[model samples]
Target: MAVRRALALSAVDRYAAMMISLAVFAATGRILGPAEVGMAVLGLTAYALIEVIRDVPTAYLVQQPETSAPAVRSAFTVMASISVLAALMLFLAAPGLAHVIGNDDMYPFFRIIAVALLLGPFERPLVALMRRDLAFDKVALVNIASGGCNAIVVVGLALAGFEEVSFAWALLAGNLAAVAVAWALSPYRRLLGIAISEWRKVLLIGGSSGLWGLIWRYTDSLPQIAFGALSQPAAAGTYSRAQTIVELPGKLLFVVVSQVALPALAAQRRDGRELKGAVLDSLAVISALQWPAFLLVACLAHPLILLLLGPRWLDVVPLVQVLAIARLFAPLELMVYPLLLAARQTGRLLLSAAIPACVYTPVIFVLASYGGFATACAYLVLIPVNTLVGYLMIRRELGVRATEVLGALSPSVLVTAGSAIGPLAILAAHGFRFDLPIGTACAVTVTAAIGWAAAIVASGHRLSPELRHIALLAWRWASPRLRVGS
Candidate 1:
């Protein structure tokens, strides 16, 4: 029951964050030009890379509750040390990176972002601790408050014509707000003192974890960096917009899974059978939703992009289509990475990421350099291969058969895939010639509704027994508000 509450709270938090982000993206794009938006992406990418680098120690700390305080102190110390070092390096390298990306104007923006990057680590580990304790309602409030403050700051700055700097300031404000909120709410009482014994233990776990972060971040960021370097700012803007299309749903799933799965996996790590069942259940549920969502996004990308992002972003439609389809498998793939780590299979997780990093880096770079944005987008074909490797590694770690994983996912895939084709066929015949907004809304609404119904039916039209009980309780609680038509 506590686990269920954590999940519910996490989902609600994600939904709130998603709503804020949608508004932020739309407002920022409308107010700032494509070049400014491109610079904002650069700032975010740098921040994202640093965040990944710092997360290893924080994650190590959060994974073990008994040692959480000392581990968190050591993690904070490590983040401080690395933050100073990274700021120095970024200050030196910002000019070079700006030059490489063909945007000299971004150098100052990158430098300003360095300040916020240093501040982020302070709050990040605290939030992780809250999550470790299954305190997601508090976590949700913190995210909403921080993100809301950021939206207001960015919008105000944009109105004052701060342009690119507006986004940077917004980041600084959010990081600062999160630090305050998380510090106030955290249960682990610790000062900023580091112990050598604690450091050694954290380093042992986090150092290896650090390599994985480096590889994963470098791999993930390469696509964006490649786009920024090889393509124009406007083109980068379009590609970035394409990413948001794929990322919205991805972020929603990721938020809930990360919030719920990590603690759940840690609690059950000693029980292999239980762990296997949990993994299978999560795979079944997440894949059912993810596959259909991504497939429908791919099918509706053209009208959706134009409708959401305005005509300037129309060029992103094809790119969004490619990425959306590619990411259909991402939810399942992503689910395993956290479970693998929680089950002490970090080495396997690193190896899985390394395979793609080795194989696809040159491919993405080569294609982006010569082939252009669409060609760069074409690199999504590697996702299935990546998922297969991850699944194999996870199976090996759990001593489970690959067939078990595949078997659970087969029904959802078939049902949703079949249902999604209907709207795609409809869109094809009618085209986008009608009222643009109405047509796109109709396409997304009808397709998603049909796909969901099909999925429910194909899942035997029966909720999990646990789910059914929860639904009944909810209806009973709301019975006073219910009205039956005569």
Candidate 2:
């Protein structure tokens, strides 16, 4: 029941969070324009770069069955210490960074962002506390409230004539709201509890975990920095929006699922069979959603761009399509990431993350610098390649064979592949132009969906036992109500 509740709440939270954020971006992006939004992206990029510090403690607490007060306090202290140090480093270096980027506007923007970090570290343990106990209800409330805070602050400030710094100020306001709400919900107290042994444990555990988190963020953030420096801020804004559009759905789902997944997987860590089963099952579920949704978005990027971002932002359409296609391979990483962390294989996690940083970074940087966002998006082949490497490592370390892994994913892969044929044919028939009229786009999409649903039924994959049971349960409950109403 806890697992069921967590899943339900996570779905709700993702929907709520994604909608609110989209609304926020639509309002703010239209008003502020891309250059100012680009500046905001740069400032926020600092947050990701510093996330290595907070990840250690959060991962530590989540993997524990129960955290002692002293352990919690110790984790909080270390996180706070590093967060402050990172903030100070950014604060002092902001001016120099702006100078290097040749943008006087970025100096104060980065400084304001630095101030938000001081208040954010205190919220980590509070978050870990709620998550460890599977209290997703509280988690959802806090997320909704904090996201509301960010939207209100950004929109209100932008309407009041603030431009570049509106997003920076929102960060400060949002972080403050999150910290305050977390404190209200948490039973943990602020303490200066310093224990050498505890610090040693955090270092030992966090050594690889922290590095793994940092590498992932660095990979995600470096392109923004490059665009900010090499391309126009407007271009950076376009790329940033593209990145956000492709990532938004996955991020929303992953945030909730990964939180629940870590603790759940950790609980099963002692049983190798159960842990392996958990990982494969998760991959299947994620593949069932991720493949079709991302691929459909790729196919339908035109109408999606028109409806969501409007005419002036149509430049993002191609980037969005490419990115959505590239993201098709993300389910493997998403499933494996939390499982590896739960299994205490942070060493392998670090190596997998490092592979991309070392091999793909230079390639992506060149692409972003010379070829632009579309070219960079095309390089997402690295994701699948890196996942392949991780897969072999998992087989070696966890003794999970390739056959077992492929069995879990192949149904969705083949089914989704079969489903894509109609869209591809329709797209080809239309000469592959994405900027179709709304009426035509609607017709194409509806026809494609209908055809896919029909194919799924015809193939009998739609009647898989799990889905069949769900259908039976739904009908059993609803048929009685229908009879009574008749």
Candidate 3:
């Protein structure tokens, strides 16, 4: 498939999944209190950390120049083994983990969620092979189907008063849906078999990458975990929600791009092409899209929370704003992992993750004791440090000089400033009140979007050409309909 088509499919999947997830969370947030949400958050945090390890074998398969049937089988076997072990460990540790987190009520939540882990080994290898071939249509189908199932189950159960365990059940339903869809759509069904002969090769390839992913994921889960264990009741849930809101832009961009980037970059490397240009181009596009969205989210956090999650979650507004600001620099490091993986610099990626993990884990744990806001403050200090470390590592591997990187990102800075114009004006007009009327909030969002498009055209950023092409295509498609109506 063409790269543009792949990206478009991925984007459709991500946006659809995002809308479904947002709806589910919105309903659940209203139905469940902070404590219940916090319990779910803790259970999901454990699940997330285990999920990272599952990606290792997938990466190994996708990065290969030629994935043999034996290798694919081995990858599944390894993934399945790891999933079973992790699920077992989580199940056995659930009680103790609940005790450690000072929430005996979370024991069942953890155990129930562990069941979802078993479904990964069934779906991941199939999806990875689809990704390797750039079969985004199938990939998108699997994701949307699974996400829809998850949303339906979660909302239904939450409404039925399942409380936090509703999320656990929803996860199981989603994974089962993913497994079934992936199996039906993937051409690799015949490749499934017991093959431990290639296990060594798979392990060697994915080990460092897996470790890197684990540590990277830890950076996200640590804050919530710490809050769950050390902070005031409901703090973890509030922080989780704020982090979720702040991360939406990044997640949307990253998921869509990275799904394409890894296999595409690996292909580019196999064909003996330079990677620096691709890396820089990715940074430019990601920043142009991501920074403006973050800025808008930061500016409109209050009204957004009120509209989407309701007044009960009003306390999340400030946390979202702070996290949005801190994550402004996040887009800079967005391409680092894909670049490193493409270059087969997995060891360097591991080191990069390790350095940041060591720096932030201790500090975030300390901050979590204070409160949700205090934990959010830690990101202010941590993200820049992490970004710097990641860039330094990327410079050494890809020779991406700081000056060149800055040159690439400068236009995005202008775009972000332009995007902020309408939102900031509205805020000022409203006397900087975080809580604006619903109609006024709608105005802020519309203005921000308009300003963003205007800035993209006015500044002639790298993304402008793509936007122009899309617009021309859109006009062409619409003109025929207009003539028919006339």
Error of 2 at 238 (Å): 1.5
Number of the predicted model whose lDDT against the real structure is largest:
3
Error of 2 at 475 (Å): 5.1
Q: What would the TM-scores of all predictions be?
A: 0.87, 0.88, 0.90
lDDT of 3 by residue, 1-486 (tens): 497798788778778888888888788888888888887887888788889887688877887777688888899899988888988999999889888777777778778778889888778888988888878889989999999999899889998988888999999999999999998998788897778988887888887777877888888688787876773448888888899899888877777567777777889899988788888888888898998888888878987887778888888998999999999867667687888867877677887889988999889888888788888888988999988988988897777788998898999989988888898898899898878887988898899888888899999988899989989999999999999999
Instruction: Count the clashes in each prediction.
Output: 0, 0, 0
Cα miss at 223, model 2 (Å)?
A: 1.5
What order do candidates take by TM-score, descending?
3, 2, 1
Ranking by lDDT: 3, 2, 1
> Cα deviation in Å at residue 228, candidate 2?
3.1
Those runs of model 3 whose alpha carbons end farther than 4 Å from true positions after fitting are 1-8, 63-69, 185-193, 231-233, 259-274, 471-486
Clashing pairs in 3: none
lDDT of each: 0.74, 0.75, 0.85
